[model samples]
Target chain A: MILTVTLNAALDITYKVAALTPHTTHRVGEVVERPGGKGINVARVLAALGHECVVTGFAGGATGAVLRGMLAPLAPHDALVEIAGTTRRTIAVTDGTSGDTTQLNEPGPTVLPEEWTAFLSSYDSLLRDADAVALCGSLPPGIHVGAYAELVRRARARQVPVLLDTSGEPLRRGIAARPDLVKPNADELAQLTGSREPLRATRDARRRGAHTVVASLGPDGLLATTPDGTWQAAPPEPVRGNPTGAGDSAVAGLLSGLVAGLSWPERLSRAVALSTATVLATAAGEFDAAAYERLLGRVTVVEHTQAASGK
Target chain B: MILTVTLNAALDITYKVAALTPHTTHRVGEVVERPGGKGINVARVLAALGHECVVTGFAGGATGAVLRGMLAPLAPHDALVEIAGTTRRTIAVTDGTSGDTTQLNEPGPTVLPEEWTAFLSSYDSLLRDADAVALCGSLPPGIHVGAYAELVRRARARQVPVLLDTSGEPLRRGIAARPDLVKPNADELAQLTGSREPLRATRDARRRGAHTVVASLGPDGLLATTPDGTWQAAPPEPVRGNPTGAGDSAVAGLLSGLVAGLSWPERLSRAVALSTATVLATAAGEFDAAAYERLLGRVTVVEHTQAASGK
Candidate 1:
């Protein structure tokens, strides 16, 4: 079973309205709520792909309880560490007429020192029975920047292949622990390496201690530099819809392929197909099975043989 | 003890931000949540005024549980009837720079037939010990528009003074049951009586079976046409701030004065002072005690002996 950790989980709420105008009253037409965070999203996608997954992280207060309750039916194993602060809610107000979305994100619950220690022990236990582990999302308050770095160290100690997906200082620090894989979006990659070019940034990220680096280029698709070789994967056509959970779906695809011992080309194909399918689906963290099946065989994967040569 | 019934209770959530722009993401600076609805707000204010208040109505689901948990410390009596459907949340996004608030209100939970019956029985038991009953807010779906009307009749049967606070069809139907008092703002009054003038509309509302009709005129204060006499109450100066719970505070002030057996002018003075003070306070349903005291002696209450000549 794959273990996913979400340091900052959220109760994702969506409000549908006719239009959103500042300082005006809106009668929301509908409310949709789901458990959300990078790891949870990945776990959801993995579960949909018939993979056994366990989710562990912080869950607290009323909103946390609601999130856990909602996650029960979706995820099989729940190993969340309870905290004192109430979990945060992320609201997205969608305009029905224009399809515009306004997002409001709360900073999420602050973790105490004991809560962090508690989580470390719980995560260690979960790692013992796990084939692979994923450390995802932002580090909550009171957690040091090296929190993911420490988790990566523990996973490496257990010889468990771990994937780290985060940005900024956490990403920089965690890479030092040499995680098996790190997936950063183009923007995150630029912010970390100060390079506008994706290939240069991916190589820089890999040199910082990531064994493999995958840079997501939005509609342009995935660019990966791994031990075997460098490869690029693109969809047949650009898919358009809510792209909220597309990245997490891609991570799930890569993780699934890695566990199944698929070739690099096959892994990239699955990742691109799943990512595109997720964008084509209605809700975040959900992909249409038919779309995934159809797109799987059509994804274009090309291997790049040219060395970086310090470019 | 005063019994306040919130047929449609809510978890009032306030999000503070630097500014509000459509279709953009906002990092909320702060979050404040409280149990809210017309009756719940009234009950909160009443509790602050040293009145023993019991809050009853549907409280269910995760949001309802959170509301009850928050209300536990503020309110002494919780006679809320449990339901199956989850409660609603009303989000107010306040722009700190402009001091403007954008509101998004979710339609409350649909009350099942069995839930309505359960609430009616609970209301009956509470009314036995209540000096006054306040039926407040809109009727949730699955409940009849005449829900408030039925509550008014029950209150009348128990010889408990009932205050009906709602709008549109429910208010119109509820007033037909001859509630002891009905407080309608300028817009609600206009909709109810089809009259533009406040005095004419107040008289029309009274004629429609409310024993007492009080028309809230926003910054202009209140115009009351009671069985004892007609009076106009205005604040010393127009108070300005958040006016979210000003009406509920006025309801609390009126109820307090009635229980204290104060004269109509004194009651009007208290209502005006409390309403103005609530606007001056930082949060809804809470009045600045010092401000209320200072404003109390300065509010102007004039007896209007000239009856409306069908204007």
Candidate 2:
């Protein structure tokens, strides 16, 4: 079973308006709410793909309850630790005409030290039964920057291959704990490596202690590097739709393939295909089986020769 | 007792950000949640001022629960009927540097026919004990435009004064029921009257079955027209701060004075004082007694004789 940890889960709200004008009142034509957070998205896609996954994270207050309620139908077996502070909400207002999105993210609930300790204890017990773990999303207030690093260390101790996907200082700190895989989009890779070139940035990320680095380049597809070799996987083409959780879907695809014991090339192919399918799907991070099947054949994976240092 | 009805009460969420740019993501610095809807806001302020107020509205789902939870501490009494759908949330993103506010209002949850029937029946019962009733804010989905009109008629039958505060077609249709008072901001008054001029538009609004019309002109203060007189009550000077909820606070002041048996000039003075105090307060719609007392003497009430019938 795959274990997913989302420290800062959110009630994601999307509003569709004719146009978004600053300092003006807008009446949204459509509003949709869903459970959200990077790990939650990955767990949802994995569950949809018929994988056994358990999502454990901090949830509190009414918003947290609503988020959990929304997730019940999507992922039947999940554990959300109730905390004191309420979960945050992210508002995504999309312009109906231009298809542009404006996002307003609330700083998530603060997790007390005792709450973190409780989560760690619960997670350790859960990880003992899990084959792999995926630690995703931002650290909520009151959580130390090295919280994900500690989780990665615990997963390693339990012999569980962990996938870490986050950005900024959290990712910087977490990489030192040597997670099995780290997925950073092109922009995050640049921030991590201080380089614009994707190939160089992926290599730099690997050097920072991530065993495998998967760099998602929007439209250009995925660039990955491991000790075995480097590879580039490209979808047939970019589909026009909301790309909100495409990266998280890719994380789900990669983890699902790994748990199924698929080859690296096959894993890359699955990741690219699932991400493309997610973009084509109406909802973010959601991919229909037919769409994924149709896109799988179109995802092309080209392996690259390992560098002299074997990165 | 003052009865306030918010058919579509909301959890008003305010986020303070550095600035607002369309199609971009922003991390909010501060978040505040308050129970809201025009009538709810009015009721809260009235309660704060030691007035006996009852708030009746439809609330459902988790968000509605949060709204009710937050309202418990603010209102003297509340009767939030459980409905079929959740209450909506309105997000106001305020730019700290510019003091500009961008509002994104959700089309509130759909009220089922059964829910509306339940609300109307309960509301009619509540009105029997009410000295004055206020029907406020936008109608939720599945609620007819004539809902407020029906409430107005009910209040009329009981000889209870009713104030209608809303915009668009609801206001247009509700006016036919001949509410005792209609308070519209300049822009809303213009929309209702098809005249940009406040004076002409207010007169037009009064002719449309509203016995009295009160137009709130932000810094210019309040304008009211009655059968006996036309009065303009302007605060001595603009005591600047956040203008959010100033209108609702003004309504609270007006209702408080009416219940206290104050004359029109005294009622207008109290309204102006409370409105100014709200603007001076750090939070919207919250008028502290100290601030209200400080501003009471500064409010300037200018009374005008009734305009010639031809003019």
Winning model by lDDT: 1
A1-311 in candidate 2: lDDT tens per residue?
Answer: 99899999999988999999999999989888999999999998898888889999999988898898898887636698999999999988999999899999999999999999899889999998898899999999999999989999999998999999999999999999999999999888899999999888998999999999999998888998987788899998767877878899899989999999988889989999888888888876578678899988788888876554344
lDDT (Cα, tens digit) per residue for candidate 2, span B1-311: 89998988999989999999999999989999888898899998888888899999899888898888887876558887898688888888899899899999988899999888888888889988999988888899899988888999999999999999999999999988999988899888989999987778888999999998889999988888877678889898767788888999888877888788887788888998998888888777677679889878778888765454334
Candidate 2: segments with Cα more than 4 A from true spot: A306-311, B306-311
List, residue by residue over A1-311, the lDDT tens digit for candidate 1.
99999999999999999999999999999999999889999998898898999999899999999999998877557788999998889999999998889999998888999999989888888888888899999888789999999999999999999999999999999999999999999989999999979888899999999999999899999999998888889999987898888899899999999888999889889999999999989876689889999999999998887654343
Model 1 clash tally, residue pairs:
0
Per-residue lDDT of model 1, residues B71-190, tens digit only: 888854878888899989999999998889999999989899988888888889999999888888888888899888999999999999999889999999999999999999999999
Reference contact recovery of candidate 1: 0.92
Candidate 2, residue A257: lDDT: 91
List ranges where model 1 is wrong by over 4 Å: A307-311, B307-311
TM-score for each candidate, following the candidate numbering: 0.97, 0.95
Share of native interface contacts recovered by each model: 0.92, 0.93
